[model samples]
Target: MTTPAVLLLIPASSYRTHDFLEAAHALDLEVQVGTDQSQVLAEVVPDRTLVLDFFEAEIALAAIAELHSRHPLSVVLGVDDESVELAAQANQRLRIPHNSPTSVSLTRDKFWMRQCLAKAGLASPGFQRFSVASDPETLRDSIRYPCVLKPTFLAASQGVIRADAPGEFNTAFRSLQELLADPELQKRGGERAKWVLVEDYLPGLEVSLEGVLTDGCLQTLALFDKPDPLTGPTFAETLYVAPSRLPETVQQCVRKAVEQTAQALGLTTGPVHAEARVHQGKVWMLECAARTIGGLCSRMLAFSGGMSLEALILRHALGRDIQTAQTISNACGALMLPVPKDGTLHTIAGWDTVREISGVEAAVQSLPNGTAVRTLPHDARYLGFVLVREKTPAAVETTLREAWTQLQVEID
Candidate 1:
């Protein structure tokens, strides 16, 4: 039998590469990591890591095809949003099971996901796609208030704003229009980059789900409850506690809506990360991505036999017969420490001390001190993530909060 070899499409900035590499090592698979920038070690070990153009799929596929001809790959996995689309195309080219490129495209565009959900009678809000060049004065009177304006392609809540009145809406529109006009964004040259989606704001607490799809069948892995209120002019998501405090009935509704949403998007296989809002016992789908949870947040989950979330995803990508991925009994959670203010971070105190706090598994600082950073509606990266596990959801939340209070940061 040939040793299983896999190709992992990883964005250069993704924090998940280490975890995924460790998982691959644990599974004893021959792993090749492909990123946008050239890796130093790839010069020595050609199969170790190579440069693949994520923005240019044709060039990437051509390179992957040539590599595949030399060394047959068993599966292709993607770690972040940008890589997932490439992964789908590579899987299709390599004759490995994967989600349709069309479905993955729908997931990337926020408005497209809304249209699919609404057409399927799933929980979706009213939405419209508008070009940034269009004048907002013409549509202001006609458009509804209490709606959200967001970039179709941007994630991590960047350029997502809620406006409760016409004044607020106009303000948000102008702000977002300026953001969209940035040459860096315009250079991307896609409908998603040029346009923004305005949609009715779903009221209530927001939550997120992580699951995997097998031949179109959805099996939920974790349901995270966002304790912080997401209703905002700028959403700064900070924490996620799992084994949600919501009733089982409510969780079931969320699961059903997510499953239907995935089916509606025509996603057949691989990991699914979904966000939704719950109001008066009804669930409203926010957005779904054909990838696992982003950032180091996946560290919050613990599966049977201490399997990391990355391991589970990699195994599923390899077509292992994993019917169930039951997590351990303990409740788990993570805090994505949000950058407090707009300035250069000079120092972060108590981070080491917080790491020693019981139940705090990892306290990592993503950006180096003295690095300039901005708050939401502008920046997408988190300061870092602190993960924990406890006996109950409440305990998990408490541990996270207690650990959070210890961190004192200075910026100027």
Candidate 2:
């Protein structure tokens, strides 16, 4: 039997791509990565690699065409929002199985996502977009207090801000508009200067669901608990505990919501990352990412529930029998290293002290001691994360707090 050749849509350095390779190996599939750098592509090539210039749409299309000429490509997958669209376009061009371009667009644009979810009768916050030309005071009057504002395309809470009143809204909106109007940012978005989302704040606990979508069929892999209440003014996530402790009924509701979303959006394949807020005994779907969770949070799914969410995504994208093969074991949790304030990295103390804490298995600090850290005006400050493990949830939480308190991460 010939091994299936999988074409990945990202550079190899990305954590997502690395996890994909691991999952592909487990499924017995040979993988080939597609990237823009010819040099990097050369290093990974002839072992079934292809060079794709994702930055330039025309170039990506041409490159995929050439690869199609060489041999049949079965599965195409990518991680970032841009890469997701490229993957969809490549699949469509080749008449292969993948997500529809429309679905990819809907997932990429936050404004459109909210519209779609609301139209479908799914619970989503009321949101509107703003441009630099819009009068800040007038806009503020129309918006609810404690609303969210950020760019439409960007993620990771970059430039996201919260305004709790008319005065705060004016100040925040003016500043955000300035950022959007920056020459550098304008160039990145092809001179499209639009302020981000203005969302009616949802009061509740936020959680993210990691799952796989096969032929528009959504499979719930793991439900993650956001250790911090993400009631947005600054909606940056902190920690995640896997195998959510929510009641069975709520879990079922979340699963059904995600599945319905995938179907409504026509996401036929690949991984789906959905965020929702539980408010007053009801679940409201936030925007969904057509990829895996970001940053160190991916590790949460791994250690918390013994489920490798990213790996499962890779296997599904590589056209393997994921349903019959994947497995999970123990509960795990992860916390992201947060940026407290804009300052030079000074020193992190008590590293040795935390090592002495019980149930503290590993601590990975991504921020270096001299690196610059900055925080949003409304967001809570976070230094780094400490991972703890135990047999029971109570034990896990106890150990986590102990390690967190013991670690002295001082920034000056």
Candidate 3:
């Protein structure tokens, strides 16, 4: 019998690559990274690394098919949103346990996801899609106030803006259009980058869910209560503290909505990361992805017997029984440090002091000193992340906030 080998789809610029690789190493699984970045080593190490056009499914499929024949991949794991659609397609063709291409594609498009949710009788916001090239002046009259205009395919809230009035709507729309016209974005998303989705903003407390599906059944692993109100002019998520402080009933409702959402999208297997808002006791589904939480956020989820979220995901994909995988006792949180401005990251200070804070587990500066950083509505990369654990959820959030204050990041 062959040892289970994974084709890990990691984008060239992804922040979570090292964590995923570390998890794979811990499990002693064979990994062949599939990335869009050109590899000079490809000729010498064809089996270890493969280049892929993540946006082009057919081309990616052809490349993956040839690789699979020689090294039989048991799991096609995607590390971020950019690679999910192709991962679904590759896994389908490889006869591996995976979500359908159609399902994964739906999760990628904001408009398609809203349509699916509304069709399934779930709470959904009124939305409309417009071409980025369209006249925002003419379309501004039809848009509802306090609506969000976002690039349909972009994640981590890039190119997402909130418009409250006619002037704000026009300004926000035009600004986002210019951003969507970026050549790099055009190459990555093509026409998916050429349109915008304007949806009536759902005002409420936001939450995130991390879970995995088994044969179409949803097994929720964590429900993170986002202490910060995401009433966004730009929604850069700040903190996610799990074992939620929400009422047990509200937590259950969030879980149920996510379960219904996974079923509605036809996602039967693999990790599912979902976002939602709770307003007046009604759970409104904001977004759901056919992958685990992004960035260092997954570190907050640790299971019994020293199992990480990535390990649980791998075990499930390998067809191993994970009934013993229960979350460790204690509340944990992650503070995703968003880039403050556009400049060279000159100096990052106080990391050592942050580590000394109570309940602080890890404080990472993912970017090097000279790397450029930009804020949201244009750039999607986070500056770094701070992870914490405590005896209670409130304490976790408190520790995260204090740890954040001690750090002094200067982008010159």
In candidate 2 the C-alpha lDDT for residue 312 amounts to 65
Q: Candidate 1: which stretches are off by over 4 Å?
A: 40-47, 187-189
Model 3 C-alpha lDDT versus the unseen true structure: 0.87
- In order, the Cα lDDT scores of the candidates are 0.87, 0.70, 0.87
TM-score each candidate: 0.96, 0.86, 0.96
Q: 1-412 in candidate 1: lDDT tens per residue? A: 7889988888777888789988998999998888876664355336577688787889999999988998899988888988888888998998887888899989988988888888898878889888887788777777777899999988889899998887888889899887888876664436678787999888898889999999888899999999988889899899899989998999999999888899999998889999999987789999899998988999888888889889998889888966767998579899998988999998888898998999888899988988999888988888888999889999989999998899888889
lDDT of 2 by residue, 313-376 (tens): 7656667667754334356666566665677768777667776776666676656688666676
TM-score of 2: 0.86
Q: Model 3, which residues run further than 4 Å from truth?
A: 38-47
Q: Write the per-residue lDDT of candidate 3 for residues 1-412, one digit (tens) a residue.
A: 5678998898877777767877787888988889887564355335588888897788889999999898888889887998998889899898886899899999998888988999999987889999889988899898888899998888888988899998999999898878977898887777788888999988988899998899888898999988987887898898999888888999989999999999999999989999999997799898999988988888777898888888888888889888768899589999988888899999889999999998988999878889977788888878789999999998998999999898888988
